[model samples]
Target: MDYGIVSLRSNGMFAFLPLGQRVISKLVALIDEEMRSISAQKLSLPLLTSGHLWKITGRWDTTGQELIKVQDRHNKDYVLSPTHEESVTNLVSEVYPLSHRQLPLRLYQTTSKFRDEMKPRFGLLRCKEFLMKDLYTFDDSEEAAVVTYNEICNAYDRVFQRIGVPYLKVAGDCGNIGGNFSHEYHYQAAIGEDTLLLCNACGISTNSQLVANPDDVSCTKCGNQLTKVTGIEVGHTFLLGTKYSESLDAHYQNEKGKPELLQMGCYGLGVSRIMAAVVEVLSQDEYITWPWILAPFKVCLITPKKGSKEEGAKPWVDHLAEYISCMQGFQNDVIVDDRDKLTIGKRVTEAKKTGYPLIIVVGKRACETVPLFEVIDSRSNKVQVLSHKLLLNYLKEVSIEQ
Candidate 1:
């Protein structure tokens, strides 16, 4: 199974291979659409920023050694932004300019972020350069911030659910951002790196850093000792309040014309990391079973075991193409594997390895009969033969649910 020029060596830094790029792109589109539905205006921010911005927020010295630093020809210092909190706050302050009318502003960005990692591994999960979707909200008061925070929280939940991943919301430490409340969305997996605490009886869950019992001795639910487990942190939301605003002097004029710090919140979802999490959670044995909504290719048409020129393989190829063309009319992207060299068994194996949701087998009989195809569900070993006319109808029904 050679990928030719598309093959990637097992290196730590180069996280995404050819197939990974397709997976990541689909996930980004899914997440972006969800964010847009909630009125989250997407903005692109710079990958590098001046050292002064970091100094203003005290991150220049305290963010540890992961900060990737550089200098211009004139020796001006710059740092690759790990997160866009300060940059976003500075932009908001400059644009809105202390007007109470502009309060409750929500802005988000999806782009590449950088951090010089001491050790980068596990494909895109812990890469130094990766895609991230970060969001920031500005509010007039703590109450308003809470409201917006909860809305964003629900939005995150919906995003993950739509992508067919079960996520756990757990309390988290405020860390350097200095926030009163922080929650991390963890995808439960055995290979996850972060530990979480949960009370099975009461359905209470929290990250180990923030877990606490009333008596500090037993679980609050069934009076049993809490169990600790490891999970992957896929997303997080924090109530930053005036932390970044005050650090960057982002004050707005209140009703009395007095300068007041704006309350702020930050939410982050690792777009590339989510790709890794998907593989970690969904892959079984030799291949991956991507959720139909997040699969890079919805249908992979394979004409394995090509017939001789006299046997008339052209009709099967044309039939498959025509079917896919009709699907494209409905705005669905389908991949047709028309290579005449590959064997039927090889094509089937490759199609499954690529994690396509639906596989359509085209043969000579398929071109002559009204029911010329068999549909294979990649997740389960289930196959059904149906009429070509019924194929589109069934796909529509399943795709809608997906």
Candidate 2:
């Protein structure tokens, strides 16, 4: 609210202001790049899906009220998508007869989803409407699907590792999704609602809900002592095998030219939930931090304070901003706080709270003979005064190092 990142919009919904939208856009770009690296094809699905498809998958009745069910003018039932397993499987069934040569096919989409939460709270963490990235894979056999599963898990780990956050992947139950194998990716945070049981002896992590008897907790792998930890779930991958494909008759032609159910897997990444969870994990007392790749702007160039002695430095500040914006890492990702009406102190404080990684000040130093600028590295809270040539080189070096 203070920095105009987001505006309140009813319960469980947020209106992303200019700054917030910029961060979301950068996050999407990073996710898309990773997906493409895995040879996943991007596509979109409708928000409203026919209840008939859900019924075929046996989830229409089992999903209960949490699934947002509705009806149209002709009295045909429909549902607002919580996930796309049923819809995606139904679509693939029509395009059947995939040859053995095209063994693995991956399709994915990033889109808005709807779920009826009993109580919506904690901003985007548990929301009625939010954005998500879901990928579905079809393989010729269970052996092949298992290989793809490991590859997808590795890709997921890379995403979090690049963000420079501490995260863990733990075994999870299939529950309503109805898969024999499952894993969840989480960021450890104090506000996390889910409890994880970790075994030190065998280095195993299991979801607390999966513990059938809390009084007798032990690692399923090594029969060792387990301790509890809290974590916010950011992503989940399910090795669904033939669950959806068999139910929906989604199949491919085998080497013998016989129809066989396609081995399938589904993976989900909560975009909005990760955004909220990252802030919860990285924010410090009075100041926020962001993943380097997800920051709204790489640098915030602050002009002289209103009516200050350095008012004559306007031209130099503008010139500096122009140069930084064209730099390799910046690529026009730098912004100038030209609101000269506000005090320089106030603007710098605002930029710090808003999580700009770098802040450059054009004050008294800018009016000096050599025209030195004050550079503040907000990420490390370090300050330095350097000449024009040195300042540019310093920023360029920082980008390369990252």
Candidate 3:
């Protein structure tokens, strides 16, 4: 479903087709649910901000050519935000009068981010523009900030687990967004661009960039043998204690009525990149092994005999579609493929390419007495003939689990 789901607009930009957008929508919904569970409020920030705001953090110069710079109609300079640290800091400083009581506030946004990548490849992995879920936390003290950091880490762990993808949390460098400490969650994929070394003895993982001696085959911390793993970075969390808060003048008053800088941390998840990374790791050939939860449509109803003057085959297909479509939980999640113009074989092939979790093809026998439907499990490549009631029951059970 490469081009069918994703269409490349330019060298580094892509537009998500309907099916691709559905996957993205589901991913975003999952992220929002987890963020809300942590009491994080969702907000929207402008896509373009004045360059002067970035200059306050000194990233305007340090970010180099990756920053997308533009000019306003009145000649004012602005940059497409690669992140929202400076913007969020400014917003908090202006809106939330800083107080110790207001400390440990978490705010997040899911928005489009821009970075002029020199080489954008591997679909959405390194695109110039992509969707991101970035969260910022403010606190009163460094000690309290670290606690909040751990909480966020736990929340991230829950998210990755819910996604059902294998990942590793390893020490990472805070390159452009400067911070004292950070951790990156990498999803194991053969096509990944980053290399990580995992300790065989202790389960500790380290990014190759932080390893002092790359040629060494042992973990420096445990002196145990290490195995190299290649993975795509999907999430990163940073403990930015007063970095942007102090620089951006986000000051809060302590209990003693003394002005203090807000301790801060930031977490980022590449929303669109997660979709692409999942595709890279879970898909084979043209079939995408969508985690049941992430599938665009849980079930597809194929009417191979549409427009035919057969023994009520098309009518049977319609009746089945209506029955499945009206099911309690799968109202909008079922697709009725009534395109009879295409041959039955071609329709089934196209549906398989879309990677629906379940494909139900209603053939001529479906109109006969004691009807049975052919159900295809896209991931296992297994076909089963089952009664209509059994197929519906199975779909509902799977949907409820997701």
Alpha-carbon deviation at 137 in model 1, angstroms = 1.0
Window of ten residues with lowest summed lDDT in model 3? 304-313
Question: Native-vs-model 1 lDDT?
Answer: 0.77
- Residues 86-148 of candidate 3: C-alpha lDDT, one tens digit per residue: 999998888545779876799999999999999988889999999999999988888998899
- lDDT tens string, model 1, 224-330? 67777789889999999898998887888889888889999999999877877876788887687776666767787776455543245456656666666576333
Model 2 gets an lDDT of 0.87
Report the alpha-carbon TM-score of model 3 versus the true structure: 0.95
Question: What local lDDT does model 3 show for residue 384?
Answer: 86
Q: In terms of TM-score, which candidate is strongest?
A: 2
What TM-score does candidate 2 get on C-alpha atoms?
0.95
Which pairs of residues collide in candidate 3?
none
Deviation (Å) of 144 in candidate 3? 1.4
Q: Residue 357 deviation, candidate 1, in Å?
A: 1.0
lDDT of 2 by residue, 1-402 (tens): 326666668786777789888877887888888898999889999999999999988889988777899999999999999999999988988985788788799999999999888898778888888889999999998899989999899889888888778897888887766544699999999889888998999888888888888667988889888988899999999999888998889989998999999999999999888887888899887687888788889999999987989999989887888888888989978889999999998999989999899999998889998899989988798999999999999998999988
For model 2, the superposed segments whose C-alpha errors exceed 4 Å read 176-180
Query: Which order, best to worst by TM-score?
Result: 2, 3, 1
